[model samples]
Target: YAGTGAQRVPLPTYAFQHEWFWLAPGVRPADATASGLGRVDHPVLTAVARIGDRDEWLLTGRLSIDAQPWTRDHIVFGMVLVPGAALVEMALTAGREAGCPVLDELVIESPLLLDEDATVQVQVTVGAAGEDGRREVAVFTRPERVDDDEPGEATCHGRGWLAPEGEPVTAPPGQWPPAGAEPIDVDELYRRVNKHAHLTDAGFDYGPAFRAVRSAWQVGDDVCTELELPDVAGSAQGFGVHPALLDSALHGGLGMLYRPGSEGGLPFSWSGVRLERTGSTRLRVRVGLADETALRLEISGEDGTPLARVARMDVRPVEQAQLEAARRSGRRSLHQIDWVDVPAGTPTSARVAVLGELSVPGDRYADLAGLEQAVADGAAVPEVVVTAVETAAEAGDPAERARATALSALTLVQRWLDSESLGEARLMVVTRNAVAVRDEAPELAQAPVWGLVHSAQTEHPGRFTLIDYDGGGVPDWGALLDLEEPQVAVREGRLLAPRLGRAVVGEPPTVDTGGAVLVTGGTGGLGALFARHLVERHGVKRLVLVSRRGPAAAGVGELVADLEARGAEVRVAACDVADRHRLTALFESLEGPLSGVVHAA
Candidate 1:
């Protein structure tokens, strides 16, 4: 199949041959033990032995929650997962048996998810040595079972090469901290990075576990950074290299990769990788450009010992699909807020101040103006005086403008708190649709302002009241102002107090058990719990779980299998509910009409 003039090299004979040979019947059992390393003791591995020659080895084991309790701490997108680093460790350990101490590279193809009720059998196989003295290694796993008739086939998760310890990399020259590097203000860095809500938009929303870039600096054409994993993630201790630690190491170059007011980037490929140490929580990293579009990184322990090196790393701009996937899969339950009600108190006769213009052309604006008129009429307090504060809309691009507006509102509130214009009367901060809701048009980009006000409310205690009024027709100021609830939504002229004892329970609504019930934020912890509840208690037979990752999410295969075993038809759809076009297309493609929707997202 080659071109007419193209030259081709003949293939060499296979380096290692695989032929089973049975031992003589007269051989002693003790001789078998002498031929191998015997038994291996590890939390996730067992039955280690050599095969063929010293260049080849085999390791078989099993993994379960009971055997590795710490795995539960490394959750991603609501699923307990076997960290990619764990697979690297297994490969390295197998290589060590074959006299290889360094890993060349490992490519992760699929995530290995641990099942809650089933033990998974693991196999790490290292092939015979090649000409260059490197051995090929592969890691595979399947569900453990007692029956031989239906043993589950193993799935390979990753493959790589290993070799004898390579030459030690020279440590950075001279004293620590490297001379002539200017320190970068970390606080401002995070502020600018988060300016456009980049964390959520770029799918890089990291919690304390992954926020390991402690500090950074810029040298001539090089970016230097210091990183350390959170103490709560525990010690890196026995790990060959903690995934979170390594992942954070890549983030150290974000300052160089990210362009202000542009799309963010993520690591796309790696080459010539090597790990020289194990269990390093703190590291120093130096990243330099490999060429026009790639980076060269050198990493060392905090004490200047060489640890790892990457010859080249290609970073690609993050696409919208990836951002949407991350936004849907990342933890949403952590940010859930529980609004507390304002305590009962008589209205003080101080001036009623409106922080911004409440006279726009809409039903919500009309309701706000009506409420203002009611305050002027002294509906709840005696002798009401009204004051209006003029505020400007944020200036600049969308992201910058949003931030500026938020800061302006906050500055005004701070000034009001410091002013001595009037005697102490409870200050009420009112805005329309200040609380952000999924799939809704945001109001005045005031969500960030609301966040600041909540913090101030906690510090000032009893001195300020925050109200988020849903825009609609005329508001019942008489009843709304009389209610002790501080945070509430006025919908259709009705005052609804959130998180207050104002809820009314009625008879349970009828649900079609035979019809499909759609659950948004499906594949999430809460969504999974609700799905089970629907299947067991409500007798729901068909369920649809919708999220950005859908069936590709880790642990989804086991989850679907379990649900199917229980006689429930489960369908996972990678649809963004916020995107109307995509959501409509999803509904159109469904086998049947949706009977109900649980908006748990």
Candidate 2:
């Protein structure tokens, strides 16, 4: 049968795509076609998306110490940073998606700490294949400052290239514990390694599951070590290699390179890693110099059966300050609302009922109540419902009226619950003249509605969409149907999405809250508290406490008098910032110049 004519075309060069398929059963990755995200099977990565029409792709997921307690144990300088082995695993996982599973090279740039209570978000990006057919991929974590809907600047933890599957590893003829390999005494091994942990941040700072190296032997120029995965997660059941065990494999050989006189020694780079076989817990590892720059590893099952091999791994000394600074960056990370641009897709073609006629053409309804009654009377329900928020400027001078506006929106939320016809409908709360763009004076009076609507959205997710316009052209009303960004801003015909970022603050030559300092929401819970602090702490003699309620708000008179008695000049202005003209007049009436402002409202 073999003699029959058979033409042999080139067999696929990449026999091992290195794709990881062992995942937790029944748990599907997050993928919504409507949002333009595709499915990703990696355990850590939940969603994947190709950027526009390009070949670049982004994969994202979230991890926390609370969920993956193993990460909680890897501490360096008292920082709970994820181990480099886990990051390489992530690189391998992402590389497979880009069609090149062979990890040609990887560099861990920064430490990503996992907060005990908060989740750290991660993103892996794969770029288009280069001329040599290698694709560059990078792993970045959003530190602790992460927003589910709005991703901010991510700190790159690692970056590398995934090449087409290279030559397969060929293990030499060997038996378990090869003859002539001198056994090294390891009685004081872990104790000696951890002895200087308190004095030097470079000590083997690992906890229970991470301490996996069981014994060691010197085989001529190479070191062979035995390791067993700890009892907590005893088997490499669903992983290419148990991450803790994989990490310990690297640790097994570090003693050969890390000298006491060295200032730093931590894994910096890895290359040509291939998972020859999938499941293994007990491992026999051989570590030797592949070249002058790095160490090579041949990992095998306890019986000397090959499991994985690395062409090279380099452990370069990294400064304590660099790692410390990375931790500090996580601690100092802050977030502010940043509007990002988005596409203006077609609005929903389904019937839409507009409550008030400020903007957006839809079926007319006198009010939310009218719409509710029409639905109650068996009228055809709209697929969408919308309303324009009225700012305090439009309502009156009292910014406290903003709370009343929120109450009105609440009525609609409650009426929707009672309407069976509009059960599947969505409510779009659009504000034409409100937003807290950094360093800009927005309609503060209309801000409370945003908070109230946000709470309702939390309680009943997917029922409400918050939209704001920077007071200009009619927004591409289709924005409401865009589930991609439920909360967005419309300005100059472009849609903007809100993202959180670290708040950049600079110091001037002098620090002063001198002269007249204004505090909005100055009568409510925090307003009164802030006024007292300004008077007591900052030694502010002149103070203006402004709230939407102003003088009419209960306890405002008492608060003003109390601050005045505290050796301070207090003026409780009954002016709303939303009332641009009234606010200007109040400033003009001031005895001195306004020095500082706090928009607590």
Candidate 3:
């Protein structure tokens, strides 16, 4: 049953799950299987995400395709994570013998929540070459396949817990607080552990649950906690703790609050979530019981704090009829928006059935256009639509083929589906300038429209046209820039990007490598002293020394290492960037992309 207006706002949703993907470090012909089953010319790799209770999850990946359709061909994908530094390197390697086009430079792109703890570093190197233009792109740390027939071998690696007087227990393989788990100093043990970082990693902290059990007081039906997080850098702004982290924290805490029996935990939704980043030292999170089946949580740090008052969830079985009814309703609801899956730069239009009344100040489009006009009248310039494909077919023209194309180009789609609970929706793109010879040319008008609105509307009122055809939605709307100034979008708006100007083409891409490689402490200190010497003598390209008081810490160490490995000779000294003499020396080192430098005190 639905609630009344008083309880109208449904709780937001989130996911908490563990996922795995196989990682083959290298794929060499010599190492290929002996079986004639087509040498592992190019092995295929797949990643699987496992939902907490459900058996399936969403997947994220990149791999090489094979000629033969049958045998499971997988490529080795891997990534390295830096513990002390916020950096992760993803690599995807192809077979030297794989009959694929040799690439000059492979672009590795991964999206990350702005404030997430882990930062990504990408390395693209030209692997072995063969007759065919085969090139290998390495994506570090390939995800583990959750469904692999082979079970994951557990290994213990963490500090062991030592009793003040009694014998210390070494964590066994597959045990929490592993045998070598970094033991917390006695002084630090009394301080609350920072599980937020772990929980935030990959949106969940399944690993810690194994350890949280160590501090269990009494397991109950649910667990809750109020935590304070440091707002050291004040980066949090306008976002809440990722839902995955919140869910995982709840999962772990509940495991502690309610042990032994695991039940009555069904995620309903989140409500009253308020996130703020105050200029405080630590982030403070408060969780309280809202009711029988709800928990209120508020998070805040020096930068941003959580404002969610409650997390409502349900745990129940679905009746077959109810499930069937839901399926039917879902299909009908989804019918509103026509989905078209196209390459990142496919040009398509959509017909949006504007719901509600269109009054004098009516039409959301008009409002959007008006807003654009206001901006244009001021400082903002009018934006043009960028098309991804050649001129769309003129309506009714025999050449205009409105058939749906497969989404085989995008591997990310399958990856997300394999690891998440969400499913891809199908939609159509309608071309506004389509010339239909017949009055009844398969009414392209669909319930919900998806298309781009050209800023030209400000100059050419009523000239807005929708580009729609049968296919799938373009994974990246940026492809529209490849076409004529034609706006494309869905009537319901795009989930990835909404404003047209936001995706303007022709902007040069620049990676902020945190300026220079940074080390901790001043140049005179440990990291800086090493950096200074390397810069003065080494063939270093650039040197960044960081010091706590001198320079605000910048550039993760893992990133510096990767840049060096990939040919961007870099050195980092943990010293202060504020020191003029030190900073000048680091910057003055004459050179085009420094060759090599050192980072030590």
> What RMSD does model 3 have?
24.7
- Put down candidate 1 lDDT per residue, 1-601, tens digits, no spaces: 6668877897664532222244322111233246455655444555677775465688877776555554565444445556565776677767766788676776665566664545677889988889898888889987666556356677787787887766456577465567898887766555554553265454445556666788987788787788887654445644566666776676656555555665555454455666777778889988877865567788899988898887776655545543334333321221233344344335443334432355322123122335445545654431222222222354646666567767766775676576443225455566567674323565555666667777877887765556566667655444444455545655445554555233232334457986899999878888888888888778888999998899897778887787788789999999889999999999988897688899877
lDDT for position 462 in model 1? 60
Q: TM-score for model 2?
A: 0.49
Poorest lDDT segment (10 consecutive residues) of candidate 1: 382-391
Q: Each model's TM-score?
A: 0.43, 0.49, 0.19
Choose the strongest candidate by TM-score: 2
What is candidate 2's CA lDDT for residue 485? 68
- Estimate, for each residue in 441-529, the C-alpha lDDT of model 2 and write its tens digit: 66666677777777888988878888887767766675555455668777776777788766554322221656788888888888889
Clashes (candidate 3): 150
Model 3 Cα lDDT, one tens digit per residue, 2-118: 564465575554331121133333222243234222332222222222334542222222221121111111000111111100110112112112222212222212211111111
Those runs of model 3 whose alpha carbons end farther than 4 Å from true positions after fitting are 1-464, 467-485, 488-601
Q: What is the lDDT of residue 427 in candidate 3?
A: 14
lDDT of 2 at 72: 66
